[model samples]
Target: MSVEHIQNSVKDVIAYLNENPQDALSNDPPITAVMEDGLRCRATDEDGNTIVTDMPQAIGGGGSAPSPGWLSRAALATCDATRIALHAAQSGVTLDTLEVTTDSVSDDRGLLGLDKSVRAGPLSLRTRVTIGAAGVDQKILREIVDFAVAHSPVADGCRRETPSKVEVRIA
Candidate 1:
């Protein structure tokens, strides 16, 4: 979409939210996952959109699909990219190029439960972004990227602690 369209859409949303503060609170649809085969699962959202995940062959999986860990990093990358686009559009900066990459360092021992002291998640995460705009000052572009990172939802969620609970059901 064009930056002008994005800016208009964002402005409309903000105007509506200002008029109706209660509408600002919202909840995303839940996602459900079902195991399909050896270490493979299909997850679907309320809209019927689905994604498949599988572990690598070394972990006794088919290695047919992307692993959950990779999906997490992809989510972060996409989220950061979206936020950067929004901020740039809002700032009236027309970007000529934009790219974001996310990665993490993980320990297999933690995932395999071989080390009790290690957590079952990445030890560290990193993101690299390359952005540019014609006729825009480099300082302004940097500020836009910094602001986007500060407000990115997925990045914030990963950087801070959040509460999660799992329930088991048997049939």
Candidate 2:
């Protein structure tokens, strides 16, 4: 999308939020994942969009779809890109190129419960972003990226601990 469009959209949302501050607090639509077979699962959102996930063959899965860890990295990449775009648009900069790559290091010992001291999550995460805009100063672009990274919701979530409670239902 063009920077002008993004700017106008951001303006509209800011105006809306200003007028209706109560609407600012919200929850994402509930997602449900059902196992198809083995370690394969299909997750559907309220909008009917779905994603499939499976483990690798070494883990006794068919390796048919992206693993959850991969999806997590993808989410981080996309979210960072989005935040950068929004910030650039707000600053009236037209980007010529923008790319974000996310990677993480995970310990199998943690996931497999082989080590009690290891946490069952990524040990380290990194994001690489390539962005440029013709006629815009490199300093401006760096500032935009810095601002976006600072405000990135996904990045914040990944960096901090978010409390979650799970409830089980049996039928």
Candidate 3:
């Protein structure tokens, strides 16, 4: 889609929200993941798009699809890149290229039940964004980057901690 179209769509949404604040609330349908084989599973979204997940051979699963942890980091990086593009387009800054890299540290001991103190998930994540645009000043580019980071939902989510709970049911 054209940048102008995207900007107009965003404006429309903003106007709608201003007119009907209570209608801003929305929910996504639950996603489902099913085991396909040894250490392999398939996750389906509400639209029926499916992604396969698997562990490395060292972890006792076939070296097939990417691990969930890798996917999580990838999601964050992609989201950041997309938001940067959107914000740049809104600002009339045509981006020739945009990239985001994410780094995370984790302790496997927690996942393997080898250590009680170690956390099972990534302890921290860092993101780096690079953008290339013709005729754009360095200051403007920095502003675009700052705006993207400040308004990015994924970036906000990474900074805050959310509670998650799991329940098991016998079938």
Whole-model lDDT values for every prediction: 0.96, 0.95, 0.88
lDDT of 1 at 98: 95
Q: Which 10 residues in a row give candidate 3 its minimum summed lDDT?
A: 155-164
Q: How many residue pairs clash in each candidate at the backbone level?
A: 0, 0, 0
TM agreement with the true structure for every prediction: 0.97, 0.97, 0.92
lDDT of 1: 0.96
Task: Show where candidate 1 strays beyond 4 Å.
Answer: none
Off by over 4 Å in 2: none
Rank list by TM-score: 1, 2, 3
Error of 1 at 138 (Å): 1.0
Expressed as tens digits, the lDDT of each residue in 14-123 for candidate 2 is 99999999999999899999999999999999899999999999989999999999999999999999999999999999999999999999999999999999988899
- The true-versus-predicted C-alpha distance at residue 88 of model 2, in Å, is 0.6
Q: Write the per-residue lDDT of candidate 3 for residues 23-87, one digit (tens) a residue.
A: 98887688899999999989999899998999999988887999988898988999888888888
Total residue pair clashes for candidate 3: 0
How would you encode candidate 1's per-residue C-alpha lDDT over 35-82 as one tens digit per residue?
999899999999999999999999999999999999999999999999
Q: List the residue pairs that clash in candidate 2.
A: none
